[model samples]
Target chain A: MSPQHRALATREAILRAAAEEFDRLGYDAAPLSAILERSGVTKGAFYFHFPSKEALASAIVQVQDDTWPRLTGQWRDRGLDPLRTLIGLFEEAVSLLSRDVVLRAGVRLAADRDVGYPGLSSAHLRWEKVLGDLLLAARDAGQLRPGVDPEAAARTLTSAALGARLISSATCRCADFPERMREVWRLVLPGLATDEWCPPALEVLAAPQEP
Target chain B: MSPQHRALATREAILRAAAEEFDRLGYDAAPLSAILERSGVTKGAFYFHFPSKEALASAIVQVQDDTWPRLTGQWRDRGLDPLRTLIGLFEEAVSLLSRDVVLRAGVRLAADRDVGYPGLSSAHLRWEKVLGDLLLAARDAGQLRPGVDPEAAARTLTSAALGARLISSATCRCADFPERMREVWRLVLPGLATDEWCPPALEVLAAPQEP
Candidate 1:
């Protein structure tokens, strides 16, 4: 590989291993030595890439930002109905957060102490806007139930989804996250979406790949 | 002072100081020395009250259990309707959690990488049962809307409140927790409770002291 490519690979290696340490041990408890050993990178190489433990953590959080918009764009491209896309996005976000070590570490670090609240983050805003925009589209298409305020629905959806993620993590270590989310959506959709729209959306959420 | 009384006072001091340390700096980050200094106790005195930092944490968590029942009973005595009582409980729980250092420490420790999920705790079960029983009572009283599942409502309320607490902690350090809970209830109540019941409950939640 070219020198530039090798440099990129080295950076990625450090991040992956560091995320594992942080996700397993938490930011305060995570050991820099463990990260370096896990990454199989030399001390000089590690220092060249990340000057401190905090720097490595910041990168993981930065990568999380990069991941979100791409995933949001990909799901939107499927051309499914808007609320359907919204449900699909919720399910997929939970799934990714459950299994993806890097993303999980980013989320955990982002939560530690307020540099800021995730609610106030651009990502939070972006996430809310994504849900909000979808709800607006659903409303325009008459997919929402009568008198449903799309903005409230969007904020509720975002907050509820955030709550479900933490709740599942705290309750079952995310073992039953998809199931927990399905239950939440079941109640939320009937309240927020039109009668005709909710049933199929629930069906699709229960089994996203079945066409 | 009586020897036994002084011992109890000493124990309270240690727990209070330790909770401040733990809440300020998470479990792994909190220093034993600072807890000792802040409590104004010697190491021997501190150990006499609590064997270890984890013990202090355990005691704090245990103390939390004691606090819950007393608070629950006190609120129940107010003789409000089931739904209002429910909203009152959420608001109070969030309010207590926001400012009570001991409760904050217990909650933070409870969420660490896990001996278990808070959801599986007896406290979680009790919390769920409390909400569930209230919802069932509401349904029987015709305060709940048609087709609202008391069991699901109970679980959802429990999860959502748990979520709201964590979300607020992560987002704003709980500065606007009351406002956040109010927003969540606004979206939630309409779905689960009668329209007439919801407005007044929301009003009470917005200002709990007013008649």
Candidate 2:
């Protein structure tokens, strides 16, 4: 491998190992030695790539951005029906909750006081705007209720998705998580649509997919 | 003073002192010696009232329950108007958030992983049931719209409240917290309410209360 390629691989390995450790033990309890051992990288290589544990944590926060877009970015702007796009996003997230232990642990770890992860806050700002823009488009298309507040709906919907994820982690079971989330969307979407429209296959929306 | 009267006063003082210390420095960081000094009670007196720091922390948690009841516990059985009750509860919580520093800090401490505070799980359980019961009552009363799942809504609402509180603490300027929370309520309530019911005063419900 080229020197640059080898360096990139080492960096990725370090972040992957750090993500798991931080998730399992939180930022405060995670030891640098353990991360080093897990990644099979020297202290020199680790410091060459990242200066401190907090820096590694900051990288994990960035990794989530890449992860989601990789998994579901294609759904966005794919010219699919907007409702379908939204349902697809929820399905993908629920799938990750059940299938991706690292991602799941990363999320719960973000809630810890010490981590101070800004990953979700950044995601919230961008996603809320995207959702708001979509809802506004649907409103102009005469597909949504006249009085629906797109920004507010977007905010609530985002919180609902997150709320489901939180519960899924706490219960250690996603058996009820997807269905419960769909129920929230079912209630929300009808109230949002102009003619009290209900999505035909709410069950499909609740179907779990492999991450 | 009677022996019983003296013991009660001393216990209350220790709880107050410990809460202040815990609120300031967090559960793990706050020292028992500091609490004793602040309360001006002997170490023997403190031990007599509470067996361990965990016991003292539990007392602090009890103090939290004692404070919020008049402000929040009133949401139960205030008639069948879910939208109104929902609005009322959010408004009350917001009002409390603005005024209650110790309660706010204590909750943040409870959520902290580094503290390992044991009272948080129990407090969350109590909160979940209370909120769930209220939502269930609303659904039964037909105030909530058809297909609106009470359990999901309750969980979502609780998460939203938690996220909002955490955000407010991090941002340190809650001037808009209540308004934002009201927007959450506004977005969800119409979906949850029956057709016959239009929310009584959405603007009023969203507005901050008079001092």
Model 2 chain A: worst 10 consecutive residues (lDDT sum): A113-122
lDDT (Cα, tens digit) per residue for candidate 1, span B1-211: 9999999999989988998877666677788898999999888888787888888888888777787788888778999888878888877887888878788777666555244332123466578888888789888888988877888777676766665665566555566666666666766776777877877876776674321
Off by over 4 Å in 1: A1-65, A75-85, A95-156, A170-175, A189-211, B1-11, B41-48, B76-79, B116-122, B208-211
On the 0 to 100 scale, the lDDT of residue A80 in model 2 is 65
DockQ of 1: 0.24
Colliding pairs, model 2: B145-B192
TM-score of chain A of each: 0.84, 0.71
Worst 10 residues of 1 chain A by lDDT: A113-122
The digit string of per-residue lDDT tens for model 2 on A12-114 reads 8998788767755566788989999999999999999999987887777666657776655677758766656666776767666566545654554545533
Question: Model 1, A4-40: lDDT tens per residue?
Answer: 9988999999999999877665677788999999999
True contacts kept of each: 0.25, 0.25
TM-score of each: 0.70, 0.71
Best by lDDT: 1
